[model samples]
Target: MKTAALSVSSEECFQPGLIPRSPRLLETLLANLDGMVYRCRADAQRTMEFVSEGCLPLTGHLPEALLLNQQLSFEQLIHEDDRELVRWHIGECLRQRRRFDVECRIVCADGSVRWVWDRGVAIYNATGEVEAVEGFMQDVTERKEAAQALQEAERRYRSIFENAIEGVFQTTPDGTYIAVNPALARIYGYRSPEDLIVSLRDIRHQLYVESERRSEFMRLMEQHGSVSNFESRVYRRDGDIIWISENARAVHDDAGTLMFYEGTVEAITERKLYEAEIRHQATHDALTGLPNRNMLHDHLQRAIQARQKGSMTVVAFVDLDQFKYINDSLGHQVGDELLKTVAQRLLSCLRDTDMVARQGGDEFVLVLQNQSGEAGIAEVMQRILAAVARPWPVGEREFHITSSIGVSRYPEDGKDVETLLKKADSAMYKAKEQGRNNFQFFAPWMDTQVSNRLDMLISLRRALDQEEFRLFYQPKLSLSNGRIIGAEALIRWQSPEQSMVAPDRFIPFAEEAGLIVPIGEWVLRTACRQNRAWQDAGLLAIPVAVNISPRQMNQSLIDFVANVLRDSGLAASWLELEITENVVMKDAEKTVATLHALKSLGLKISVDDFGTGYSSLSYLRRFPVDALKIDKSFVRDIARDADSAAIVKAVISLAHILNLRVIAEGVEDEQQHDFLRENGCDEVQGYYFGKPMSVEDFTLRLRDEAIRGAAGK
Candidate 1:
């Protein structure tokens, strides 16, 4: 480690003689320099020959300690790791007779590492031999550390951009892509980030499905400088539309100049589609795919609003006639199909401006908008009636059904949606009361009728609890024997307020309200008990028939009848069950089964008003019935009208051929009685025999008739 001695002073190294300057001024200049000025020998030890005053601050060592290698050699101050590279660089420069410059690490006297820049030249002697190297060295650690920190930050930013799941992007304000990550490319349906950036040059036209969305985005950005959860529909690279949500901010430089827009994008197409489906299900009926009641209310309100502008809007409530009978008899499956068919027919019958909505279970509400007057509405209503009446095939059979439509016009019928619907419903019930299969315009009178019906329904419920109903008996005379054989048990509602409520007054409503099931059961039990009581009192034991509605037939009628007969101790033969032809023809198969069941229980089953319904003769043969009652309409004119008389004769002949008895109803006069008696009619029951009377009156009449008969015999 032997080193050369210093042979040069600081003044000599700075060449004051060549510059022609004072030593004091030169010393002051060197002292003020940012780094140490030095001369070193061309040796491995690099012995220092001259050192400036700055050497104390730069190297944390005194100039005397550095000069002449008094305490430490300059080569020893060089960092071990950078010493060889520095030597090689300086050596090559000296050989080429040029100045040398390099940056390397150095160890300060305090043992802290410093980055240093060194610049020097080989000073030559007169014979071209190397004397020493002159140089200046300065600390550059701060600049080097700053550059390293920047490089590390850039690496971290690149990692985040590549790995993020949400799309990250930077775009110029002019809509050109500045930078985009892989996630952004995937969201836009591109193969790669480069492809997306290259292809999507115009974001407004190429990205947004609606051009206005882009404008909106820019407006929001300008106003608030950022947008969060901004949703919009945009086109993917493949021309498919998708929903996207963006959270973006306008990036700016330190001087507040706009640099670019940076944002994140999320694909939300699946979520949007799911939300739409849920909305549709909420507003649509599941069975018929029609607008449901909720949607109908909204639609009707809108229609009323439209009508307020001097135009009429008709709200029609359509109820399918006999739909419940068909539904209960066949099954709910057929009912649903029938409703769908009705909905389709209703739609076909109306203009495109109209709407048909399902108000649940065989009920539809129609909105006819912007009508001219009654004529226009009437025509549409008629069309609806005709359309609904058309025969439709269900399963293996072609079924015919009808609609009862009630129409309430906006402005004329109350002002609001509920009022219009209420009035329309009331009018619809009137159509049912007027014998169904028709349409009725809402009249103010219908409101009172609706209220009365409502009151009656309330009373009917109370009547059941309070025993407000009474059974009246009408005698049936045997036309062959000229003797009373049996009686028909008819129900009478003796209201506390009204004297009597006829069967026709509340029967239809009770059926519609589903109260008939309970009421029918009550009637059966009471009629059976009364018949057994008459037998117990030593009156002639005769069969008493109780009318059965279609609704009652669909229930457990056979079981109910058996229970009644058991509880009343009346033989089933003494309690006949009467069913209308329409009820039997509704579902012939089910009716046949019910009839057989009753017959098995020894109850007489008669088809009442037989000629009124369209019953197939083939199926009629299959019904296990004891008798067929000629409809009152036919019997009312049987004596005078040849057609009625001929029909009655044919029915009696047919009944005899089938080995069944025939009863002619509504026989009001001697001519009618003689006509039925001469025509082989087995039984007769009507006002002619006697009007339906209370139990006590009928019992007294029976006693008087028995006395008179005994005397006549």
Candidate 2:
């Protein structure tokens, strides 16, 4: 740092203790001063005329050595590098008739360099002849070094500010740019900092894509004195959007008033895009490219919450029919294509606000929202069904597809995601039961049915393990001679915790829950053993009919029945397996083969509920069965319903034409029996003969009937 020398009068120079005759006190003060005090001749050498004792430390020499020319002159004491500079400053000050104030390094007696400030003025004689110069001299080496260090720090900081990669900026509180680095100009797509500063004057309105972002930045700065990683979308000079994060603080003046904001900025657009992709993968199904279960759960929960605000939300569980068979037959690659196609179809049937998520496999869950009755839910379902049913061509083959959908409404069918999904699933099965290719809304009754079915399924398994089941027989009497020729064994469940559960209450459920297969085997083994015991006791040789469920028939029925009979030591002829008419027609060829296999083992086969199925004369002629039992539904209306009576007669005639003995079941009155007897029905089994009874009761009845027949004969 340098400063201009001030004009100084002769009196001013004398005031610094340069009087011609100094008092003792003034002399002492001059000798004790912090710096060298001197009066020198105005000659070229500037030979010292007077010198204070302080010069000993300032120049590393005794006062006597410097006075006059006894030792090296003060002019020689000035460093070689600064001698000309010092002389020029002093000469310039003298020409201006002012004082000289110059800083230069002076060499000490030990040859060490020290910086000093020299200030002096010329003294004139009474005739205006320049006499000598007098003033104070101070050693300022430490101050000079400190100033040099500060200048070096400032230079390095400026270099770094120009070259840093991160965009650095300083702006006033009112959003005017005070300064910006070159990197900031490059990031914002400007030619230079000058171009950026001039073109983007209003930071609030011009820089940010979202108009309020700048305001938010200001607010954070106001509240916390700083904003770290404050991110936002911003517009570049070319109007392209980019993401940025800023770390800034409000710069304050000494009195704590905000002056400006300074910060560093980073472009984060690519990082933001990558993070979005990760989030999408986490929430979406990979195969179908639809929302996965994780997303479904979150979306459904949000919809359920929204239901509180008077808006309707529907959850539809869609299951593709025969998907497993198709997937297995065509391979997983085709299955994946099928799923992808169905997902697109489902999406087409829905609005942008609606969600269709792939729950997994062949199942998808749909969420429909804000459906006003004016714009019907049924209409949406119809569109979806039609979309799914469209012909899907895979390679050379074009195939038609179908789906079963169950709908559950928010705040009505259910109030939560899990409950709605579960109920919708149950209703989807009901759609399948109603013959597939349709949709059904969840009903309250369906819940009860589902709950009861679940409880019965658990109970059924426990019943098998605990022996809570027993078989009761209903006598099948011969219409020709009033003889007991056969008895149908009906299962009765006597649970330890509840009343006896009739077969009708749980039999269908057992079949659905896949519990009937094992239950059927248990019935077969138990009935065989009991029949063998009855024959050993010398009772009549009557076949006991154990009804086979459709589920059991699909399994290895022939082997299971043969195993039971062999184990029981019961002849196959005395154990008839009764199958429902519908069960036989399901897969007639397979059923026929299984029946023939059983017959070769000497077991008789009877078709139960004979009149209530897809029964054809050709199929009947083909079935190698011993008898056809008429379903109780028609028999219940036999006397009054002429159509019922006509149907019954036709069935009997059909059975006889096929050489199958015709039996009428569910007879509850004498009128029904008399009608069966006169109509040529070969056998009758009903409550009229006797309601289903225990084994002991059946034995007693057989003995009583035998006694009566003998007496009548």
Candidate 3:
């Protein structure tokens, strides 16, 4: 922080009679002990007419000798560089008859440098003709140094304000963006500050996504005279919403009248994302991306508050049965996929207005708003059961898992969030007791098992290690050949100690326990390895498809798949990843990224259970999928049902239009197979041919097929 040196010389002076002065006033001012006062001719060389006593203190020259136009005049004391400029200023002021001020350096008689401020005005004679210039001078070395320092400081601040990384803004009291630095304009996605000002006339309405945000802002301003950490969702110029935080204050005038507000706006999109992820970690199931315990409590409370008369809110507690044995025996990888699949199916069953939350390990709570008592709740429960029962492809297998749903209604079950949740949870046990894949309304007698969740956890963990798991593969047939093309891997568990454990039983539990990440990795590796073994045993290298859980499909999945392919020595084209519709829909961009990454490794990507997911036709083209596998539910009735047939046909046409292959699953008869093949299905898989088999059994069957083929040739 350095500044240029500055000073004023005596020859630089110009004086004017802008103010009428009393005769004695000038004499009294000159008598004061600090600086000199003088009058000089407005000429090339300033000729002195008057000088004050203070001249002795600065230049060691007496006033009488300087004032009488002596040989040692004011111009002689000025630094040579400044002498002419000072006279020029005096000449201009005299000719213009205006006030003048100048600063320059002077070399005193003692050879010391001094800074001075010369304030002057033009002196005119009674005839209104220019005569001379008169002014007062001060030894302003200290003040001049301070002024130079201030100018430098202003320059630095101005530079930073213009080139700052974060946006800075000054707004009017009523929330209009008055002035915004360049950085702010960029942050708001505007081309320039002028454009931003012209377009964003009303910040509260134009910038904030919600109108009520203005009220919140005003409230904060009123309460605290300022606001910090004030976050709101706002729109960029292109209407893309982002989050920003403002540290702002109300600027007031001298009398405390409100002038305007000035604030610093930090584009916190990245920070907001990080904060949201942290919040997600705290209140969401890491594996399923569904709300967890803490968030569920908040949702329940909100539901209770929104409860309407006659139309009661319903809370359904869903628990997957037999999930533990599948996890322990087959591996946690299969278990995690089961949970993610279940979560997705549950989400598909509910409306966007409803809430589907995972309340830790095998327990899911759903909030149905304004339902018409038990009947309304029953329909939802049935849909939940159907969705859970629908076949899902796991690794290289296809299996089914069932859920037990317990319902509790507002007021009838309990009035409070916790009470309703507790009742619904207890009733879930009743559904489990009656039979899996059924729904039960809350009853007072079912309270006994509500507090036994710990026991359920223990049972699940034990199921996994006890070798209760089994694999079920659904057939995939070539449409042209009428032959099994491949199979989708699925898993099941039959527990000796517990009759049978469903995937829904322990999948959620493992996910909530953070065991899904490792578990999912295992499924990928195991399925790939199993497929490679089948190929090495002389079976046609059909794509062995494995479902990818969302948690496993992120960044790490890319590396994991590449590693598994290397270890198994399998070509990427031989492996297909069955990703559900919902996973791709959650974050279209990120999902596209994950799909591309897998695709880049030469693996085939298929949209599993295609019709059952939230489909955005616009984004379908962006997915790096090789095929769309129709859900079993659609294929189950595609042969006889017109609507199912229509949907199936449309999906096939759509898939073909997108250059994606179509595969039909759950074709239980020849008619279904004929219909699928006639519709140009690239492949078909279901009970029509064979169910899933062990790796050895599958290889033996392939050998038999090859022997048959050779005999026919």
Best by lDDT: 1
lDDT, candidate 3, residue 428?
A: 84
lDDT winner between 1 and 2, please give it: 1
lDDT of each candidate versus the true structure: 0.87, 0.86, 0.79
TM-score of each: 0.63, 0.51, 0.47
Give the 10-residue window scoring lowest on summed lDDT in candidate 2.
Answer: 1-10
Q: Where in model 1 is the C-alpha error above 4 Å?
A: 1-208, 213-278, 286-288, 305-354, 358-413, 424-446, 592-597, 616-622, 640-659, 670-679, 701-713
Model 1, 198-279: lDDT tens per residue? 9999999999989888889999999999999999999998899999999999999999999999999999999999998789
| Candidate closer to the true structure by lDDT (higher is better), 1 or 3 | 1
Candidate 1: lDDT over CA atoms?
Answer: 0.87
Q: Write the per-residue lDDT of candidate 2 for residues 691-711, one digit (tens) a residue.
A: 999888988887777688778
